[model samples]
Target chain A: MTRRVVITGMGVVAPNGVGLSAFETAVRAGESGVRFIQELADRNFACQLGAVPPLEASHLQVLTTLERKTLEASGIIYGLLAAVEAWSNAGLDVPGNEEDPDWESGCIFGSGIAGAEVMRDATYLIDEGRVKRLGSGAVSQVMASGISAYLGGRFGLGNRVSSNASACATGTESLLLAAEHIRSGAATRMICGACDSGGPYAWGGFDAMRVTNRRSNEAPEAASRPLSATAAGFVPGCGAGALVCEELESAIQRGATIHAEVLGGAINSGGQRKGGSMTAANKEGIVRCIRHAVENAGIHPREIDAISGHLTATLFDPIEIEQWSVALERSGSQFPYVNSLKSMVGHCLSASGAIEIIAAILQIKGEWLHGSLNCENLHPKIAECIDPERVPQTFRKHAVRTLAKSSFGFGDVNTCAILRRYDPE
Target chain B: MAPSRPDIIDRLHRIVEPYVEDEEALTSVDEDTNLLEDLSIDSMNLVDIILDVEEEFGIEIDDEAAEQMTTVGSAVDIIASRLAAAD
Candidate 1:
């Protein structure tokens, strides 16, 4: 028997806001987190604008001095803080002192490029013959699995503790992986999330590729213009998002608050074939992923009330809209309400999927659809595919029963998750 | 002015305070305090404490000596000897 999975708690350290309440309010108001970063400009980056979570030192007061001393990796710090919030939000004990780990709990946290800053520092120290000065924690911080390993140790989770990387789809893919673990009865609960570090080091390559927005560097607030006619390129962003997925029965047994039910999802790769390339997705593959997700969720496309899109404010925004329209066979007035978190938080890279999923769940629970920022002048092609009324320019209160959220990465990989309002039968 | 032996031990206590896992050990840390047993400083954190000492005292501690710094007194001895040699 397949076990049912539901989101019991969620936490977000987004560029727009550090916590769920703040983030939800910012998104509802269409607030932009993109800003002019002086460090990027000093480094001679083409696009000097980026979005970064405003993390203060007090946010990490729970860490020990040793942990703080060794904490050079920004991604790990963000991931851990977000995980703690989610754990507590689920009404779980913080700093649990159980003699043995809860063998049923696990984590599948991901980071696209972990510890680049620490690696760079280590390289410099080693080059200068100060190898002893390269602290022992350097290796742990630089490893791709650092975030998951740290979380596993922190929470005493004994189940499969692992990290996954698939560029931008990492966060969404992680949630789907956790759902499979529960569905197959491998684990009862799992903490899944993804994080990315901000700065010139993490975003230098994209800046060099000229894939970041350079047109609105002076007007940082309006830089990330997703699904708009003035859209240029994506603005690099960093932060973390976490969700606690628990078995439906397990959550109810523990009297946990159910945020939303994980109906089902699908993941696929285009193999970079046909029109797909290293940086672009195949339209057919996208459509297939969406259809498979809806089918797996045992819901018809017409049942989807809203869409949380991976619209990165690039030229591909219209293409993404078209793919969704074709996959659902809905266009013009028939199209579902669609919004992009990237419009406010910029492109959070690996963290985008989970962060956007948090926003989607919040909207579903609150019975409202947040507006898509900077899309007032919608792209002509996107307008041709969906009616302007379907894309709200401001927040609207409407009951949404089911929501579909998707994330597509640079390597032609796609993941779509179907979420439904929990109506216990 | 060069720090005396007692001064070095006191300073080491402050430096080691951060990495100590046991609160009681932190309160009564002295020359005989076993870094591993009393403070519960793992090998990874030991390396960081050693690095901190090196930076604080402006001395070079090779890997061989760093491995032998298992107790608070042992660390103080190494730092004092290195300081004397420099003088």
Candidate 2:
């Protein structure tokens, strides 16, 4: 029989901080992780930067004896922190818990780019001095799969070690793929998420595309206004949000504190229609994923209390999400209270989906939605996208039945994962 | 001058023709026939044809030649030119 996967525990190293408690405080307070690009000024680029929490490299000492030789940071640190938190949350020990060994625990986290600092340092080594003096570990450090392999080795998680690179959707895809593995009986548990270290290349790439928010230069906090009509664009941020998903029965037998249920998930390519258009998002693809996820979860559309959207604070992308909302409405159910995390946390690119799902899990756990900060006036087209009144001071006690997490990537990749409330009793 | 290498034409046709859905209509297609407008191959399929041609001809196309080889005729010309340049 197929196993029903559920998130037993979650840990995050998001732009705001390194733990779920810190992340929650930042989200509720509507903190902005974006800051002025100090390094990019040397490159002559005009884009704001987002950095993950200052490396308390001391935190990693418990996991590894490797000294902090270089500040070549990426999402790798966030991945490690999240994996460790997840391992503990699942009541598993390093090198695997007695009940479910590390060999049965898979690691499937990803990042669009890895070890960006390594590249930055490597270029400096070659351009400023000698090529032969370049760091030998540079290539291995920056490999896109480095985070996955590193976590796998660090924790001895040997079941399935791999990384998915579907641009911004990578993190969410990693989670969905993990859930699929559990459903297929391929593994008993999995650790999945996406992270970025936050730097100039992230800012410069979006700057070249003219998408990073440059406004509120004086007030960096207000720069990431998602859903607000005055919203400029996205502010780049970095971090990792991960969960420990296991077969529902196994989690209950072990008395794990189940956070939420991975009800169902669906992924699809945005075909030519989406592929041909650059700024245009394929509403059909988003609708299809949502529809399939809802159907697979065996939940009626009305039961979906909220949707955590990709909402990247882009001009055209928000409109695409609104279109998705309309499509959902046409199916005879009211549009779920939709909110974008970007408004509060800034757009984290590859980390967006994972972090957004983190919000959904929290919403399900707390039974309340955080209001979209910096959205003074909502977009008139989807003004009902999110109800501001639902924002709460603390985790709500009521059971939020179902929530959908949606993400869209550059190559027209639309992915949705349905998270449901699981009662462990 | 007309090309006399029947083997080259056969190999190229074998690589390109199989990918085209409508084989019977274009069974007698010559090297000069357009791949896009004439054969109705979309841009995406044209890219696949480019990859297939490169593998069959054992020629590495530079970025400029890749752009120049938009149509089948242009692609054939670019491949023949690359071969001549290499020799």
Candidate 3:
């Protein structure tokens, strides 16, 4: 028998807020985290604005001396911090004198570019013939699997510790993979999340692609205007998000505080076929992915109470809205409430799916849908697909039974997960 | 000028300060104080400490010698010998 999966704990190191409570509060208040970065301006980038987690010196207190001295990777730092918060929030004890690791607990933390900052530093050191000064931990810090490796060692988890990379779909895909692991009894619990580096090294490529909003350098907060007619492009963002997915029975036995049930999900790629390209999704592929996720979740399309879309404040926002409308076979007043965390925190790249998942779960747990920020002038096309009322402009207290969250990535990959309010039988 | 044994040990203490969890334990650390047990410095961290020592004293200690540095005294001895060899 397939075991049911549930979220027992969640943690986020977001641009808007460092912890879960702060993140929820910021999102609920429609607070924007995007800011004009002076470093980007100094580098003469087209997009001088980005969202970065405001990590204070206090945030580094948890790191051991070795970790603090040698760790230069921001993504790993963020990922590890978020993982620790999630682990503690789950009420799991840190292995002190145990000879063996927790075989039942695993980690699947994902990253797009794990250690760009470290790599840049290493490259400079190598060029200067200071290669020997690179330090022993430098390689680990730059490795793509660094986040998972560090987390696995820190938590003493012996099961399936791995990292997945699928651009923006990574975080959502990690959760789906964790749920599958739990359902198949390979592991009783899994720590799933993703992180992305901020600043020029990571965002330079996006800026060069001219895909980031460059017009809002002066008014940083208003830059990420998803679903708006004046929406320019996605604001680059960085940070990490994590969730602990445990077997429902194990969680209940441990007396863990259950948050939401992971009602199945679907992951698919457009294969860059038909109208799909390296960056854009094929319309049919997205619709199929969403429908399959809802079907696999054992829920009808109309039962979806809300949608946390992959609306990255790009021109594709309306197209995403239309796809959701077609996939669920509901539109206008019948359409569910839809929102995008990117409107506040910007697109966090690999970390977006995981951070947004936390936002979605919060909405379900609180029974309130936080409005998408800066979308007051809703795109005409999107307005035609869904009622303006469905696109709330402010936080609204409403009952959200089942919420569908979708993530689309650069490789034309798609992942959708359905989360339901846990009702113990 | 080559540093004295006590000077090297004092510098080693400063280098290992960040990795040492118990700040008080560092004060009483002697030749017998195990780097791993007493200072909570792991093998990976031992490597960093050794590298920093080499950079600070302008001497190179091979990996085998580094592995043998299990205690504060051993680290001091290794650095002293490496410095003498350089001289």
Candidate 4:
């Protein structure tokens, strides 16, 4: 029999908040971390607004100066901080310098363009004929798997240490993959997360593509209005979110506090076929993934009381809402309460799914839903599909059972993770 | 003129200080103080130390010279020699 998996710990370094408590408090209050980035303005970008984690000096206290010195990549630092928080929150002991690695644990942290800052710095050094002076940690900081490597070394993880990449779907994809690893009985636990480097260089291409919001730079918080009629585009954001997924048996043995059950998740690609393109997901592929996740989870789609959509406040929001209705075979008042964390944190790219998953878990555990901020003028198309009241306008007490959190990234990659409130029975 | 031997040792000590986690191992550091074995500085960090030394003194220590810098004394020797040669 496949081992059951559950999320035992969660951590987040989000644009609006850092750490679990801060994020929970911010989400509960409907606080938006979206803000105007002066650097984007100074850089002469069309999109002058962005969201980045407001990390303080004390946030780096978890790492020594030496450790801090090596983390040149912001994404790596974000991933490491979130992973550290998740690991500690799981109540697992970190292996000491001389201690043996925990063979049963591993990490699958991912990033999208995380090495931009490091590579930019390295390019300058190389141009100056200081190639050898690039230092040792430079490559690690610039490598795609750097985030997972740092996490593995810090925790002394002996099992597989890998990084997944699937654009905006990366975080949820990683979560699904890590959960599968535990269920396959190959590992007992895994740290699954993703991060992104949100800055001029990393976001410049999207700006060139005109996919980021350009109209609401002045009122930054009003920029990312998912499921709204006035959504110009997504407000680029970055940070990390992490969850510690453990086998139920191991968790029970350790008396760990189970947060949510991983009822299993599904990931698929549209193959850029039919209406799918390099930047958009095929509706059929999304529906299939959702149906498969629900079927594999041994639950009917109607039981999914809420949806944490991959709504990035773009043209895709309506399509995603409509697809959920088609796949779940439910609509109108029967539709689940739907919300977008991106409505507050903006589109965190690879980090969005993981961060939003944490938000969903918090909402599930507390039996309340955080408002999808800045969507006051709900898009008529979305309203046509689901009841307007289903998308809450503010923090409200609403109990939800199984929640379906879906993320569709560029290149037609899609993932739907089914998470349920852990029942003591 | 070549940099003073004592000055080179001091600068070398400071450069390696950040990489060394074993504070006590750093205190008794001498010419024979092994970088990897005693100070717990790995090979990857040794390259960083070498780079910092090069940046600090503005001299390029080639790969061969960098490889010989396994101990505090050898590292200082390489730096002193490079500085003298440049002068």
What does the interface RMSD come to for each candidate? Answer: 1.3, 20.1, 1.8, 1.0
Q: Which of the numbered candidates is closest to the native, going by highest DockQ?
A: 1
The weakest ten consecutive residues by lDDT in model 3 chain A span: A91-100
Writing each residue's lDDT as its tens digit, candidate 4 over B13-80 gives 89889898888888898888889998988778888888788899999889899899988888888888
What order do you get sorting by DockQ, best first?
1, 4, 3, 2
Q: Distance from true position, residue A344, model 3, in Å? A: 0.9
How many pairs of residues in model 3 come into backbone collision? 0
Q: What CAPRI class is candidate 4? A: medium
Which residue pairs show backbone clashes in model 4?
Answer: none
CA shift of A417, model 2, Å:
0.7
TM-score, second chain, candidate 1 = 0.91
Stretches > 4 Å off in candidate 3? B1-3, B20-28, B32-40, B58-71, B78-87
Model 2: how far residue B37 lies from native, Å:
68
**Candidate 1 per-residue C-alpha lDDT over A1-425 given as tens digits, one digit per residue, 9 for 90 to 100:** 66899999898999989888888889888888899999999999999999999887887786666678678888888888888888888877544654788789999999897677888888999999977778788888889899999989888898999998999999999999999898999999999989988888999999988889998878998889889999999999999999999999999999999999999999999889999999999889999999999999999999999999999999999999999999999999999999898989999999999899999999999999988888889999999999989997889999999999999998999999999999898
Alpha carbon deviation, residue A349, candidate 2 (Å): 0.9
True contacts kept of each: 0.92, 0.00, 0.85, 0.85
Q: What's the lDDT for all of these models? A: 0.90, 0.71, 0.91, 0.91
Better of 2 and 4 by DockQ: 4
List chain B TM-scores, each candidate.
0.91, 0.74, 0.91, 0.93
Q: Per model, state how many residue pairs clash.
A: 0, 2, 0, 0
lDDT of 3 by residue, A290-379 (tens): 999998998999899999999998888999999999999999999999999999999999999999999999999999999888989999
Q: How many clashing pairs in candidate 2?
A: 2
